[model samples]
Target: MTSPAEHPSAESPAPVRWGILATGDIAHSFARDLALVDGAVLHAVGSRSLPPARAFAEQYADEKASPVPYGSYAELLADGDVDVVYVATPHGRHTEDVLACFEAGKAVLCEKALTLDAPSARLLVDEARRRGLFFAEAMWMRTNPNIRRLRAMAADGACGTVTHVRADLGFVAPRDKARLWDPALGASALLDVGIYPLTFAYLILGRPVEVRAVATLSDLGVDLAGGATLRFDGGAIASISWTQTGWPDTRASVAGDGGRLELPSPFHHPQSFTYARNWEADEIAEPLIGAGYAHEIIEVGRCLREGLTESPLLPLDETVDILAIMDEIREQVGATTG
Candidate 1:
């Protein structure tokens, strides 16, 4: 746990320069949030083709910052000006993209479900450690102020003898979208949106001793919807459900003998949460911040400034562990990667 001041790289005074690795919707969202941070800059963008990359740069340009556009990801990685690269490529491409960034001597903030499987995640983590390059999954919710507060409260035993945790996230995704149905792209509810609920369970209950799951696969063989029950060593249980075929409640809760915490709908990036002790009135927790992505973006900058190879909040081990859980769930549900 070295402080930023003690780390040698902290001596640098320049703000972090970010290079986005793709021009997808998520990439655009990240660029928008990056604008909200004082010292962070969207310095560059890259895509497989030049037009989309240039178009993204033009679309996201601000008065003070106009990002350089690169025709290919290789060019973006080669840019010396980019201190860190945010890998927004599809799930199947995350491993290659992040590894390339490391090889190019750039730090990384890769999007979540880090890769299609645990083995790929381990390779990335191991490489990051070997290079001492800053790396973290874009689990932005973990950086949310309210989530931080909830974790702190839970750690302090706000919920006495925690026994059960429940979470779910689902939506009716457009079938026409190739990303949602294309087997080549690693499309599945579990890998796509289900990761959120699974992560919520892991955050509240820690790693599970056993994972039991069932899923409904689409005609194309990817999961359309799924559910899992995780049993922990301490006998605590977490039940998580998700779907892409239809919308579910999309709420999350952590309950115990003494109290419970309830996040509002869309708990993954919740604006507020309610806490209740026994029969007492509910206490609502709310914290303000920009489009939610800013927290993780700011976190990447902080870790880079601190000369950290990984975030203390979202360590590489935890990221890999979560992916392993997904791997197991996929195996149990018979959802094979096409």
Candidate 2:
């Protein structure tokens, strides 16, 4: 419920320096967003290869900005000028990469599905706290204005206690040995893409008391499609589905005693929501700077600029809780990988 724009520390500090740790697709999106934050500076970029590092740095750097290109992640984290590092690695590499950044005494804003399981998630969080470093899962939806407003409306009884929720996020991923379909790369409908709907339910319903899940595994030995039913203490329930093998509706809707809320397109990057009551319906839209991920990156800048170790909106605890649910869901679906 906290608003970064309203934070009192907004007036007192300079920009937050960033050292990007990957040169992947999401990394580009994040870099573009960071550029929108007035006081945020992109100091450097690092990747496993020299070409990618140089290419990424050139794309985000300005004539005045001195962005170093490092062929190794260690070099990126070693920069004393970098206040925080953004991790955009694969699902399997997240735990190790994030832990390394923490050890280097840099704050981190990692892309989500934080880790493959709960244990790794707990370890990363504990280490961040112990090191007094800011660490947050980039579950960007938590910081989205539309999502924020939706949660507020739900909390204010706009949805009347949120008795039941249904969310589905799925897409047709091209078949390949790459992460999206590769078992070794930790590709699965649930972990790779399903986390959004699962996180959505958690954001609205809190942690569930019981989790029931089922999935259809691909020949690659990874879950290509799945669904889960989560039950909370007070009879509140959530049903979520995800798939990487087929194109799905990819929508999110919450049903309450009085009404329901519907998100039209990218449920996670929601731009609008509709509240319906019998014959009356109203739709509201929320626009963003670019791709909506910009808001989250800007928020990270805000938190660091103010010397805060954790974001009030997307705290590490909520991330841990979301990962715990994912762990359980994975367990029930019998998709176990380290």
Candidate 3:
């Protein structure tokens, strides 16, 4: 059987121990998916307090291993067995937490939108580069099998000079969820949901020469809903939208002179994609592991086994570039720091 990257020796390395910081909802999902990764162990978990940390560890414990629960992030970072740390904190706390991981000489897989601003994201990237540590933005979509196939097909001209793309994601977010509306939490539909569609477009068309965007800001100054029109080379354009206001179809499609492809609702984690050319159409299904989060965990494990500092599939520079684009979009929409 062919290895994922063919970089590691014929013999597999020891299991990669993952240390998770913050027992938030995202961390729960990541931990559960760790079970699906062939060579990964949930060695440790940390939270602000011992109770929640212990609870999370108990819930995800398996016959093979039970993750050590730490009451503080520093305690987890200090653990010698932790090969890497997954920072699941909110956008605002990412920089501080990730930098702490680096200080402890631990590798890191930080959540998407690496930081609230471009400069901070760059700082983290520079630190990882300088330290020669493994680091990646956990933009899980980019690691999806179907999305990877789509990107490859588009690049190979399966869609023939792709000229336009359309994608939107939205839902009526509950006001009680402070993270969805609180600017202090780095809350914004654009940051939370818009990044998916925007990254999808970027994977296909690369960087755009011009981006014209506008948004409807919440009373608190975060963007509740917005849209952006990006113009890429050869005049390819992508129309993207997101909202915390109401339900949207959440569908995405890409068009080219030769054909077009459509992804179902919640396209970011789509189960399949359909491509139509002339009189024929084909729907492609790519099997997903666990809750579809396994792919990323597997990628991280592969990188560690290979002793690589970053993933080739989702480079650090790409993460910084995407964050820079969001920074510009936020500025154009007049989003506040909150």
Best by lDDT: 3
**What TM-score would every model get versus the actual structure?**
0.95, 0.93, 0.95
Window of ten residues with lowest summed lDDT in model 1: 1-10
Clashes of each: 0, 0, 0
CA lDDT scores, all candidates in order? 0.86, 0.82, 0.87
Model 2 weakest 10-residue run by lDDT:
1-10
lDDT (Cα, tens digit) per residue for candidate 3, span 1-338: 11123323327666778899999889999988997787788999999999999999999999756999999999998887788889999888999999999898888899877888889999999999998888999999988898888778888888898999998998999878888888998898888889988998898889989999999997889999999999998999999999999899999988999998888888988888998899999999899887778898888877877778899987999888998899899999998754
Q: Per-residue lDDT for 204-273 in model 2, tens only? A: 8888998999998776568888999999989999999999877888899888989999887788888889
lDDT, residue 52, candidate 2: 94
Q: 13 in model 1: Cα distance from truth in Å?
A: 4.3
Model 1 vs. true fold: TM: 0.95
Off-target runs (Cα >4 Å) in candidate 1 are 1-13
Expressed as tens digits, the lDDT of each residue in 189-297 for candidate 1 is 8989989988888888889999999999977789989999999988999999999988788998888887888888888888878888867856566664677899998
Could you tell me which 10 consecutive residues in candidate 3 have the lowest summed lDDT?
Answer: 1-10
Q: Answer with 1 or 3, whichever has the higher lDDT.
A: 3
